[model samples]
Target chain A: MKDRGLPARISCGPEGSNMQYGFVTIYWRDMIRFVRFKTLLISSLLQPALWLAFFGIAMASNFDAMMAGMPVPAGIHSVGYLTFMAAGIIAMTTLFTSLFGGIVILFDKNWGLMREILASPVGRNHIIVGIALSGVTKSFIQALIIMGFGVLIGAAFFAGYAPLQIVIGILGILAFVALFALGFLFLSAAIAISMESPEGLQGVMTLLTMPIFFASNALYPIDSFPEILRVISLYNPMTMLINGIRYFAIGPDFYALGHHYAFTQMDIALSFLGLVVFSVIMFVLAWWRFRKAVVT
Target chain B: MVQPGPAGDDPIILVENLEHTYGNFKAVDGISFAVKRGEIFSFLGPNGAGKSTAINILITLLTIQKGRAVVAGYDVATEPQRVRESIGIVFQDITLDRDMTVWEQLEFHGRLYDMPVKDRRDRIEELLKLVQLEAKRNELTKRLSGGMKRRLEIARGLMTRPTVLFLDEPTIGLDPQTRMRMWEYIKGVNREGTTIFLTTHYMDEADQLSDRISIIDHGKIIISGTSGELKNTLGRDLIHLETDNNEKAITLLEHLPSVREITVRDTLIVLMVNEDGTRVLPGIIDTLRDAGIEISSINLKKPSMDDVFVFYTGKDIRDEGQGPARPHFLRAGGK
Candidate 1:
């Protein structure tokens, strides 16, 4: 090591003055990492588009013929399956992306970077909230990409709505997506903290995400399921979230296919409020688990 | 640079009855010590002797469950932010972000502490130069060698220019040359008025560097003093005498004022001497001859730090197999 006669002191003006500095530093660190990897950005955008291309079209092709034999429900029709699946896929993308967002924290824990951050002068709340905010931003951006791709493929279901209604719809979708993303981000963080190794976390992610995705109404209407599964889907938060997205973005009349429940304003509000409460609970749980894990 | 007072007045770090537990086991059992400003103090122990746990508590990484720890004038439990601001820590485990460049890692740490942009740049440049890592500033940290990564960690720890620095096993797996170079950098940093709290199992490193040393074992401090003082706890010199008749030599030399203890093994009579074993060698030779015992060869050996460790802990620090309590996720000795 050579001596370059660098200044000895590093000025850190006051104790509480730079509290926000920790938040900005953490947020920028995640964003810079996100931007630096072109492959990550490309891959994230590509997965949902492929799901829309393969799954959306495959289901749409069979729906008209399939509905000809069976009666169309009161609020849904066979022709609108493509539009319905598009909205559902957007919710699924937000759900999956946010669920895995805490992989960053898992890496930090294993590599000891989390310990470094925990030992710093920064407030613990800032660390958790900063990561959650970044997850929300990433999910929101990806949701927009899905919408753009859907319109590019000539779905144009959103084209029918007025500009103001579109703005209102996007706000509702953003609110629902943000809450949903935060809930899963906290869930992932909670699991990552208790986990000793990344392999354990990986197993949990695989086991949980599939059941969470399939059991909900992201791919099908809850009423179409068997009795037991119908009860499970009715209470599954993801089902409520998908229902909220359909009401706001796709309009109330096109809410579900062969569904038993009516799409009322009360239902939409309750779904949105349910997610908010879930997010807060998970956030508190994650913060508590984080404190216990880092100490040991 | 504040000039600290004598050893007992206002230590930079003060701990009293600190305790920590893991389930039913007490990892740190009510330990207390003080470190003066600008002094290099070390806690020497084997792998699971609670050195890292105590350090974790002092640096505010772990909350103290049953005692008080004050670092740089703030209580570790109540004023963790203040404690964190006053100290910098280099963990025993590697904590660098592999994807980041060396410069980027330092910049991020500086930003976390809220340094002004130009000051952060200047400090990073100086630190890179200090660690001799200027050329590797733009290279990803994962590409650096084990030694280089250790140096980068040190540079990052110093980015905030903390009042006190805690280094946990700073030279655990480095090559000899790198270890020596790191010592030079550490001494240089200390000379510039930073109080250093170091922990390591390397006896010679502690012996060579620390002004005060504390030997901890089984969650309790067995002994604490300077290296010389600890060595003196055993006799100052060891005398090995090869004789034709060992029993007679032991009988004749057991009463000598200079000798502390005498034991016979095979054809050799080993004597623990207090001081000037060489000056008393002729007297012993004459006495052995008068007693009709032939002295073949005589040798005097000064005690090393290993002997000091053995004197206090009853086992060599490096020789004891690691305990089951310290479970490393990554393999040890892999850097």
Candidate 2:
């Protein structure tokens, strides 16, 4: 037979031990899928703005009227309800986007695409880390869109701040958003790897989002809740994320909904720390699941 | 055609007493074999006969539950990363992402193996031509025909110039014409010096494509040899006879020196003959006629792979409307 100039076999020597960026490959493929699905791309970007436009406007008008006659502390800054919930909207969009980010993993597993990845030389942890990175990217995009659109529709985000402070505030919100998105994406990946079907994963996501979105202070204040729910909301990572968002977007001290909103530096720091801790735990969980997973 | 490696060279793949179980069911039960370098080896068996499970274990997709597997000189359990690096796989099912274009599918595989950009690009061009997929490079994988998808997978498997390629049922679900074309591509690949380990249920596939064949059933290697050697084990020729009285014909032929073995399938009697069937047919006909028995039908032919498979496995591999036709006798002992 003719040689056909086939490449020689790769030697498994020290040269083969060079650092492998397999996760980047995984991330690249995911981004291809993200861009290739036009409907998915448009819907994910538009969903957050629609929520801000319709829900934020209707609720803000009602809450702003009800709090018109309430007393504001002499030195405190009083903001409209639209401004208050704009931050909430950002956090909400991030929550929805991040929670559903790992759905791709489940789809790949079901459609047999995961077998190609698992059988390759890539480390299993790369899959988890790669998915988390892309999830964070999606969340960042959605959060930025909501921020821009929320301001265009009369929500006073970063109002009265110097240009430098606006940049800092945006970065701070993204820092919190990145940490929070990582936490949920890891959790989503863990659940997805363990699940057998897409329907089962969807059911679990619904079960989770209901308690997480409503129980936290995203849509309304959690202070007037019953004693048990108030305590639960205090420890909820969603509440921690919103705390960071409000502290950066709004001022340190603001009043709305007949309640005084004040965040000490220590409170913001602890909330940031809470997100870090949550994400770390979630990473460990996802890593464990990936290590245990077997795909053929 | 690629010649088999010399006897002294180490085999590309080695498995010794390898066993695996899922809960209480042992999927790969104590099977051992080796694939020499520069040759095509096949594991031929029916579905659920542990072919896929064995392939999965060799590819490092499943944890090694028991025994040892060394692929391309790396121990699968202790050095799976090295094994994975040295081998490529075409899984039983289509594993392509529907949205990714044909070019992207190959690109993704190259990147997963950490191929340099220039090499990845050049190899993609070369393989696109090799598989005749250049025109479909920009089309989505889902848009390609089933045969095209299988060819793309084969190209992807060759991206890193792996030492060994594992193909599990490569031409499954394709038309007959496409299957023949796929065989040519596989042979073309083997000629280029990569060892191939394939598993299939099609008898002709194993007989035509493999340099060595191992017939597996119920997670055990029942027999292994070249296709010629396997067919030779059933003797020179096979004689099929349908007589009014099969039991009497069997009784008459059991004592003949040329009749090596007799198998009864329904009313048909299959005789493995030691001499040429043409010479032996006259004696068998006279013997049956000397008695009151009369022959309803008769067929004589050289042993084919189908007959060899039936002789050993005692049943046809295809799952059609017909029920299992287990031969009453003639179970060939394993090597």
**Leading candidate by TM-score:** 2
lDDT, candidate 1, A1-296, per-residue tens: 01111112222223445555576777777886777779998899899989888888888778745665666665452335666778779878987888788888889878847877777766555667778788899988888888778777745455578899998988888888899899998898888778888888889988887877898888777666899988887777788788877777677765334444357898888888889888988988886776566633
**Whole-model Cα lDDT per candidate?**
0.79, 0.87
TM-score of 2: 0.95
Worst 10 residues of 1 chain A by lDDT: A1-10
TM-score of chain A of each: 0.87, 0.93
lDDT of 1 at B123: 98
Model 2 per-residue lDDT tens digits across residues A1-296: 11111113211222245425767888998899888899999999999899888999999989888888888889888888888888888888888888888998988888847999888877666788888899889899999999999999998889899999999999999999999999999999999999999999999998898888888888788999999999999999999999999999987898877778899999999999999999999988887787778777
DockQ (Cα-based) for each candidate: 0.37, 0.46
Q: Cα lDDT for residue B24, model 2?
A: 94
Q: How good is the docking of model 2, as DockQ?
A: 0.46
Off by over 4 Å in 2: A1-16, B1-5, B320-325, B328-335
Winner by DockQ:
2
Q: Per-residue lDDT tens digits of candidate 1, residues B1-335?
A: 12345865788898999999989999999998888988999999998999999999898777679888999998877677788777888989889888888998999888877788999999999999999999999998889999999989988889989999899999999999989988998999899888999999998789988888989888898888888888777687767788888876787899989898765434556677888778878888889989998778887777677766655666656557542332112111111
